[model samples]
Target: MTGERGSEQGSPVRNGAGPGQEGRQPPVIAIVGPTGSGKSDLAVRMALELDGEIINADSMQFYRGMDIGTAKITAEERKGVPHHLLDTLDVTDEASVSDFQRESRAAIADIHRRGRRAILAGGSGLYIRAALDVLEFPGTEPAIRQRLEHDLEVSGLAPLRTRLELVDPVSAARLGDARRVVRALEVHELTGRPFSSFMPVREYFQPAVQIGLEVDRELLRERLAARVHRMVSSGLLDEVRRLDSLGLRRGRTASRALGYAQFLRVLDGEADEEQAAEETIVATRQFARRQLTWFRADPRIHWLDWQDPDLVAKALTLCG
Candidate 1:
């Protein structure tokens, strides 16, 4: 399912290595952490050292023109390593984890075909799992989905969340968005099964390694707060102004992105820029906490201190 390899440098993993190339090692690396934990930086370092490529698992990085807020690494930062799946979607379009699973698998396979290491990096938990694990997506009935959407629009998320709470408290508690709430209801209505039943067990679809960056909670909070300030100084407001012209508010997913959602208020004159920036920081810190909680539950992840000078070497050791 891998897409075309963007470079011709290294040998892919062993399974797909050609004749006389049985000795070549295929790398499947996942770098996961909180939002401001320097995951993209470490991923780039690993790619350069291992002759690998990066596949983005962060849902926000998928949107074009969302660079500054998502903290997307620049082209120069990639340092000639071929990065996959960034800036692939319109800001107005919603990204589906299942679609990401299909595309990222293809990209990783293609990276393997080229005999290069495949590094998956991002803070998005489910998207990362959907790509690297044996996750199955439930089928959606268009009519059922339409009805749910209708109900959400008419009655708001309360009724739908109540329904989901009755059928599946776990999913109801886990999900925060109206869209996802409606989806859980749809799944139950369609299959007579709780939405949680579709969740994949903790198992990889292929041989893989996960490197998690661990941060001190207070330090991470300060870092996240500082990062939000930098984004504002670096023109997050202007970026939102640009995307707003492209129907960002109408977008079901992109509209809800931490910084984007808050700044949209600024544009509408609902709040001042400083207020928007403060909200973004608060929201980002909460997001980072949730991210840490999610990754901590996975037993397979190898945790590394975020500030360790030899973090890359430590992560490499785990790959073997």
Candidate 2:
């Protein structure tokens, strides 16, 4: 999200979409939005209508056995439309946007090869960009990475975070996780440039169409709270408990997930489940805000009202 770039002049799609446009130069359709904004449902509808297969851009949904917490779409919910990149990683595996870019593009290529429209869907802005934009990841040096990792362990993130703020404040603000923070710091150390400076200039690596979903902020907050409550009632705690035995706590990214992290405190006797659920709701809401902020910066995305009655029909028209 931090490194992603786009125009600020993005306007909503009108009835003047390419209705007769098909197969001339096939476009990769990207569905993006804030969490709990129904991006997945909309994507499924689009995929169904367009004879498309989906390539996931949601980073959390990549992990296996992370269904409930991440709100991963169930197989039945997939409606027999083929989906790529879900449950492809173990909870213990670390995921980088670079790796995601590589894998997702491959999936997209395969979907195209099969003569199906490739629908990219998720709220992870950078992952989506990595898959579709001309973004380049900074090369890594093992020794530098090792040193940063050592520093992180010995002194904790505060000092390293301070350094990142001084050297690459943009990356520093966008990255809350220690792993990403350390990587950003390493990039600065290795390249003598701010991590953000390597961001993609507003250009796509592949021709693509981006559709954005926007929700009223107040309504979204209420919806997010209710969704988190539903997650708890639907066995998010039990899911975490099962994952913890599989070394989920050791998983850098998985351990830091909104619900999983808060519930970890509950499991440790530091909080109650209700309190944990409340914390999860608050954290998820904050995450949704960040997501909105990230997508809002990109003006190329055709914005659509999330609750529009003709949302699917309008989206298909845009694709057409």
Candidate 3:
């Protein structure tokens, strides 16, 4: 699924090409790839090499007590580079893409004002787009949203899903959860347009370069499995247990995280640790595949070998 890069080596990577961005700034560098593909490590290395700070694009890392399961970078790993938007939410708070876009743009502006380059890093594809792309979120109407949510509560997702399929089949095919389904219907009700019509075009809101780490599918599968096993070995259950006590199960988003969900079942006696580990490994691999599919569709990202010894240097060249 690999695609050709839009810019070549040493070519000036275009920034702020979207409409109304006349005073184009230096590109905000973003590192993107599937999970367990060493994105965090590479991001830190690039930040140090370029004298930049990091803005997290991973939604799962937003929760305060979700470190181990999300594989969040430690303080030492940051090596003094200020990372924004990590651990900014309680487990009970739902993550919002619109909120993330506002916060990330603010952070990017702050970093640039301080004369430091802004580096955005994470495997969350949509969050990455929200930060760097010229994307618009549909406004929500309180009455419409409340009504759809009430419908979802009373009749279940089937009715809402059917309504979405009739009004906005593209989103219906794409969105599977109750929350997103209700959101799609709400967007349609509010704007009288298909939810998919608002998908971001290939235009940057600011000067930006995306560097994607390419991995062999089989090798990535192995790495993800190994990583899940390591998380289990390194007190992931204890971390999940603690978060669960702090209202993890009450969280609409955090409770459904890949590793955390599987282990929460283990905590409830529905599964054992071994069963949870295997389930998490399988789910993580599937998630990686979905991430690859989303990223590969974008032709602007410069792809690099994850194992390349000079990965940072290559990425820097792309950033120019």
Top lDDT: which candidate number?
Answer: 3
Over 6-95, each residue of candidate 1 has an lDDT whose tens digit, in order, gives 111112122222454434545479999899899999999999988899999898898889999999999999999899999888866667
Superior candidate under lDDT, 1 versus 2? 1
RMSD of 2: 7.1
lDDT of 2 by residue, 83-145 (tens): 988888777877667667767877877787788999999998888887777767677777988
Ten contiguous residues minimizing lDDT sum, candidate 3: 1-10
Predicted candidate 3 versus true structure: per-residue lDDT over 1-320, tens digit per residue:
01111101011122344565436457899999999898888889888888899999998998888998999999999999889999988888778777777779889988887878899999988889878888777776668878988888889999888988899999999998787788778778877988788777888888888999999889999988888999999999999999988999988788999899999999999999999999999999999999999999999999999999888889888877
Q: After superposition, how far is residue 132 of candidate 2 from its true place, in Å?
A: 1.2
All candidates' TM-scores? Answer: 0.87, 0.85, 0.89
- Global CA lDDT computed for model 3: 0.84
Better of 2 and 3 by TM-score: 3
**Local distance difference test values of all predictions, in order:** 0.84, 0.83, 0.84
Q: lDDT (0-100) at residue 269 of candidate 3?
A: 100
- Residue pairs clashing in model 3 are none
